[model samples]
Target: MADAASLPRPRRPVEMSGTNQSKRRTSRSWFSRPWASRPRTGGSWHAVAWIAVAACCLPLAGCKTWKKMTTSEKTLAEERTYGATADQRIDELAANAKKAKASSHADQVEFTQGLVKAMLDEHDPRVRCVILETAAEFETAAATAICKGALEDPDERVRMAGCTAWRKRGGAEAVELLAVRYRADPEIDVRLRALRELGDLGDREAVPVLATALEDSDPAVQYRAVGALKKVSGRDLGDDVNKWREWAADPDGSTAEWTIAEGFRQLF
Candidate 1:
């Protein structure tokens, strides 16, 4: 062998061609990119340090408790918490209501609390409409507030939903609420919803409102009022508007004149 000083070092590897050259260029470009091996200058390293710290912290950031096994605990704690968007919140409330249907009474109360919280926090009219329906799931005072408050809600859609909610929860109170909504609500569709619900309720107490609706300028309102008056009064004197108007004009006096099945009830 030649002397060590006289021996030529092996030449650097020859430049590659075609696919190998392309791959090498790509690899070099990637590794030599701006963020790769970035020089520590001024706040640049501070940013990198924060980025590294963030990367290390990301998995653990959800845990403010810092207690072990609390990730699952925190998840359980937010079971009733509404989601960020209106659609997500609606889905969450719907799921909670479905769960509450089979859950124990206490669990249902908890669901109602979440529901009321969502309702109070919600600003979207569409979400408020959903809240009116969800609130019908429980009879809690908070839930009732959500349902009843919807009748007075600024959104017409929510007020309409409130009418439907009370219709499902039929009673003297439901009749009273529907009657009041029919009279007091300004939106024609909402008023129509109230009138329709009152008709379904079939309570005699709704007669006054239904009769008043008969005179409304909106022909739709007058038509609904006639149908509601028929159901509520338990009289089927045909769909003649004039006859119904006369009876509305003097309900007690016209009762005997328009008597049909009601007379049978009295006879029995």
Candidate 2:
């Protein structure tokens, strides 16, 4: 019944205002705060971030790997990678022994003895001498074996090394054996070496054998015997000096002969 002009306007839903839109945007940002924590803005930035993390942790991983390697693993790796020859291996072992820190002296002695035994058994005389030189470090039965074998070595240098080994481990039996050989050994050098070893042993029982050696055809043997007898029995062969001088001056004397004669003079 109302007039057309007076008719009521149609109602619509409430529209969002500018202030409401702003509030909605702020609320959305707050709700997604974690997503906004992106890395620096650059290409490959994500890859660099991951790499940085790995780099920081790589040393720790490497340390763990090193810890996992055992002593045996290290030894095998060295042998395989270093291409050690027989002599090289022996030298390596010797160097290792010197550097090793054993828990006890007995363990060190055992290790040294085993090393010497291995070298002496090597096919080469030079290697055997290397073992003989180190024999003083070992206090064991292996030294005894080295001495016995050295007595007959084809190489005089090797035999001399054996004499040194015997000196380091001299005993009554050891001196007696050398004394017997000093008077009877066919090689003048062997005879001289035996006398020197006996002197190092300093056994009283060796005196008689040394005295008998004075009659040997080799002046060097005779010279060594006189000095050795003097040491074992403290007796001076005063007039026998002339005999030693005559032998030493003999043109027929060899390097071994002169060396042995001189050693006697030095000892006496």
lDDT of 2 by residue, 1-268 (tens): 8898898888987888999987786677556756455323532676789999999999999888878999777667767986555677667667856754343767666766676557646777787777666665555565556567676777877777776666677677677667656655667776788887786576766655665676667777667776775565443434384554444334244421445456588889
Stretches of candidate 1 off by over 4 Å are 1-83, 249-268
Worst 10 residues of 2 by lDDT: 248-257
| Candidate 2 TM-score to native | 0.50
**Clashing residue pairs in candidate 2 (N, C-alpha, C atoms within 3 angstroms):** none
> How accurate locally is residue 184 in candidate 1, as Cα lDDT from 0 to 100?
85
Per-candidate local distance difference test? 0.80, 0.66
Worst 10 residues of 1 by lDDT: 34-43
How accurate locally is residue 35 in candidate 1, as Cα lDDT from 0 to 100? 63
Clashing pairs in 1: none
What TM-score would candidate 1 get against the native? 0.62
lDDT of 1 by residue, 1-268 (tens): 7799998899999877799987776678656767654444534868888999999887777554446546565565555574356766788878868889889988878888877777877889898888788778688877888888888888788889999999998889999988888888878888888999999988888887887887888889989998888887877766677778788777788453666766577779
